[model samples]
Target: MTQQPDTLTESLSLALHYAANGWRVFPLLPGSKRPATPNHRAADCDRTDPWCRTGHAGWEQRATNRPDWITRAWSSNPAYGVGIACGPSRLVVVDLDTHKPGTEIPEPWHRFGITTGADVLDHLAGAHGGTITPTYTVRTVSGGTHLYYTAPDTTRRFTNTAGKIGWLIDTRAHGGYVAAPPTQIGSSSYDVTDDRPPAPLPMFLLDLLSRDQRPTPSTPNDDHNAPQRPSSRPYRPAGCGDPVHSTSAYVEAVIAAETAALNAAPDGGRNLALWVMATNVGKLINRGLITEHAALDRVLAAAAGHIAADAYDTYQAEATIRSGFHRAATKPTTSTRSAA
Candidate 1:
């Protein structure tokens, strides 16, 4: 039988394949899942390389779907493996791992004789009155399963988590990476078991994953420690004599409100909505009420669903944000007051 792609040509081909499929991919060190990109301190950067254009970027920020970046990276070291940045790719992957030797299944599951992550996931699904839906799946080198799903469109965010669902089950969303097929460590390789496009994250699973992130009700004493809630009143620009509304709470409220608007913007006006969001945040940046990085990150995340749906790509979204931000930043101070 013909074996899976394993040689240098195959490795580069696999990386390119993932990139062409709209996944933001990065280089993994040869024979390991660790990122191959070298981290640098801001003071050490020359800013001459493509990776250092904005600042010293990490693997997540540098992950790319562009063919040129993919080809250059893989061609430099053909043995390097490929890793998918889950956030940029708009994926939430459930990692179901097999038990190690002598590892006892944790409490709550041990009584039920659960062994692997798959078992825990199945149990969780069964409890929800459903079964695990088949999605694009990968078999890890250690006999684990990575089930890929299209993340939900809601503004709520998710990140990497351990044992969030149940014993031996983990998830990768924003701020996570997964080694892709053909990535090898020692003799074995990651392999694709299910090649279908990712299914939308199951509602039951989404609820379970997002449950812990919800804010809990606070006791009377907690009021002192609780963050200042955003006011229901309309947001007014800073330096307008209402310094009371110029706190970080206001900046956060502005970002939250704009992102919500951006996500709901219809097809014909999504880009315009994106620009408005960026510029609105940019005005905050100009007033030093918010940092540019914070604004850009939230705006990009807000656009992730649209990008995943092919409404626009990352490059387009980023360019629009930067352009709108710069335009607002450079506007005359006198005009800034009434512009908002």
Candidate 2:
């Protein structure tokens, strides 16, 4: 039968396909966040396992990416939407909601002193000796982002919980589930903004989650999809690695050094400081984060303004930039600063 795209059948078809990828799938009510499992009308439905036939709401027990299980669920209720069981998929979703209380439209994230939770997440990951590389980001039609991360290792499921982690933030883990992208609800749809796969949960973030002992998993599932660890090796110039992979904090460090050196350059420390900028930029170049030629060009461009503002000659600035590059190739820093 020809399937109508973007309809319930299409969503169910997707649930089946996700099952093929080892993502445990369940059905949700059309145009709503509620799971479409049996016995959903019961007051204890939220706490019950929707998937287990032995229990009232065995949704969790029944959740599976297996073709047969998905087939049976959708065959009964084709209108049901896709609910991705988070734990077995080895994914934990960090949901950043933008809606104000009792409102439909989204509120500005900055009102809560948060710009992007993912940005705060990156710094937090780096501070705790974790790698911050590309990961999947979901853009909800409600103008919010869902950051996907690896689930912590445990046999049973982690229950869904919200708000204790941060302002407007919630987690979809073990017993909890998330609406897969393209899952429509009313007029909005969950969509993958960043197509990258999920990154592993950082040890630091895991520590914070450990505090919430509520809703722990009841029975351990036989399936565990431990994701393959991807290496995050930025290019090391010669042998030494770059301290900053062109991160915001690193950029700020370079600017501070350059400004101070230019101010005190009257005593001839200008060359040393300029050299520092070159070394800093060289690291960026080696990592393939920025081009070497572009680095020198920016220095020259910035030098033009500094020269005009400080009333310094063009020769001195250009010479200083060149000298730095020379030193970077000849005498790179032996002991690099901490990556944090």
Candidate 3:
């Protein structure tokens, strides 16, 4: 006769198997109470109640009428759904819910599910490009571990099987699960410790984290050294604000046609360069770094050099004409008498 499997034993066995394999496990519960303040409940508290009529309306709007209301309501009303997170060499037990069935597992944890904590750590090391040492400890409610490893960059996010079933790791929603407070009823706490230090995380994940540390671009034309221009003339950058209409090569060719115009008119060529600079300056102004006047001043300053040279030639030609006119005026009466 074939031996029959026990349902409870199967569940426990499964949980243990994952614990050994490096998968994090969290248990679900029906109802539980959490820590409350002395003034936590009052007539005005109904508005904040997750299951109150008004509160439900807000939840419905945001969650699109999904059954996720159960979790939301639980989060507000009480604490339930306690579980542990175990991975290779590490473990953490907390009060929380795993992702609902059918939720997508993050790419990082897709290949591994419900495995021992050790296996999870190994996979993270070999496949995901990080080595996480297991840290085990005991919480008020349960025993668990923490896996610690340096990430190459912080820009990247991770998702895993626990999150696929509505579980959370470290409260960042990497796996769609959120951490619960330990004080809640039905909520279990966990501990974390590492036998060995974890290796650095993958370069890709590290790169993502590094992006967060970068400074934002500065605003345009705030510099005091910007150029000035004639009082009456309006400042306009040459060849600025051309719309990008199409992806076709023909469109690019048309844009390049402006180069010929620039070659024909030296002033226009200078104007084109000024226009490009002004456009970039405008972008900075929008970001709130430079004042509008400051941007204009910079554009005007760049145009000044070209304008000054042109103006000198123009003034010289005008002066010659004026001198000729003065001489003609002195001799003009004799020519008019002969004609009469």
Candidate 4:
């Protein structure tokens, strides 16, 4: 009888295989996304074990195509999960999750109410042309799949996206990382559905991932017919002989509104307020006062001190801010006139 390979051998071999295939590889905690190395930047672990925590600091830069490094990493501990650095590997992965019965997804995300990874593939084929194809696919533990394809350009910075293209359709691209199969999280594993060579992303899909196809913001509302409210009593539009609608003023208004919302927001409502502020800030970001990243970091820092609810996932917060910011950025820079 043939004996099964030890877990260490299996993990090391898999890591080497990925490196040999030109895919940059790194090790993650056995059952978590945490970097296996003690040097992982985000880890709060004490530096007692120099060897374990001593790598790229985190998955972001830990991936490498070097065979020796991969070997050394796995030889130390074979139970680690294999992570693929997306951009460095020249790959992009579309991650589709199975939505529960009553999630907050957009209405009619799936026109046919389609289900399963296979169904999504079929739908994409017709919608995005023959180019909407995957080079390889991996079945996720959540009944979803990570569809991998080579990127047309590795230089473009792509952020992990959520539900932008459609419902349950997220993307992991540049500046992102993914756990490959054989990386078990408890009793489950990310299993490869196919061993076929990954093909380059179809042009249409590449365009979507490139960030150039982002939706433009609509024209600013004149508020010519807005309902009268108590909030309106304190402020009025710039009267005649006043400066043209100032984006800066508009931005300040947005900040004030958001701060009020943040203070009054109930547990679930704070997240919504954060989302709205990010959108408004995006419209005025061109004023040169702040940046998207800096803005978010500042807000999050404030939340750490002021917010009483559980913090949101970093990616989730970033995605929400990005989507809102991008949409608002496309809007007219001219501020609407206020009636005093």
- Summarize candidate 3's per-residue lDDT along 1-340 as a digit string, tens digits: 1111124443344334434444343434423322122123444555565445554322112211122333343344332333332221232222223334677654233433632333333432332223333332223233333334432333444433332111233312133322222322343433223333335443422322222122212223344564544344443333344332222222222112212111223432344433333343344344455445544443443343444444322233223323323333444322211121
lDDT, candidate 1, equals 0.72
Q: How accurate locally is residue 33 in candidate 2, as Cα lDDT from 0 to 100? A: 67
Question: What is the overall TM-score of model 4 with all chains considered together?
Answer: 0.56
- Model 4 Cα lDDT, one tens digit per residue, 1-340: 1121257777788788888889888888778766775453445645455543553254656679888888888888767788898878887788877767765543233434655444544544433223455468888877788888887755566677775444567888767888888677767778887778888877645543442232221233355574432321122123323343333333433444344334444545456655655665665565566555455554443333222233444445556666657755775342211100
Higher-lDDT candidate of 1 and 4: 1
Winner of 1 and 2 under TM-score: 1
* Tens-digit lDDT track of model 1 for 1-340: 1134557688778877888878999999888999998656657888876778887778898899998888888888878889999988989999999888887665555555667898777755543334588899999899999999989888877899987566788999899999988777888888888899899998767756754232221112223553433323322233333333323544554555455456556666678767867776787788787667656666776676665555656678888889879877886242321232
Model 1 has how many clashing residue pairs? Answer: 0
Give model 3's TM-score versus the native structure: 0.23
Best by TM-score: 1
**Model 4 worst lDDT window (10 residues):** 229-238
Q: Where does model 3 exceed 4 Å of error?
A: 1-7, 24-28, 31-203, 221-239, 243-340
CA RMSD of each candidate after superposition: 18.6, 17.7, 24.9, 15.3
The runs of at least 3 residues in candidate 2 whose Cα sits more than 4 Å from the true structure, single-residue gaps closed, are 1-4, 7-9, 41-53, 99-116, 126-131, 154-157, 211-340
Give the worst 10-residue stretch by lDDT in candidate 1: 214-223
How far in Å is the alpha carbon of 172 misplaced in model 2? 1.2
Q: lDDT-based ranking, best first?
A: 1, 4, 2, 3
Full-model lDDT, candidate 2? 0.57
lDDT of 3 at 283: 40
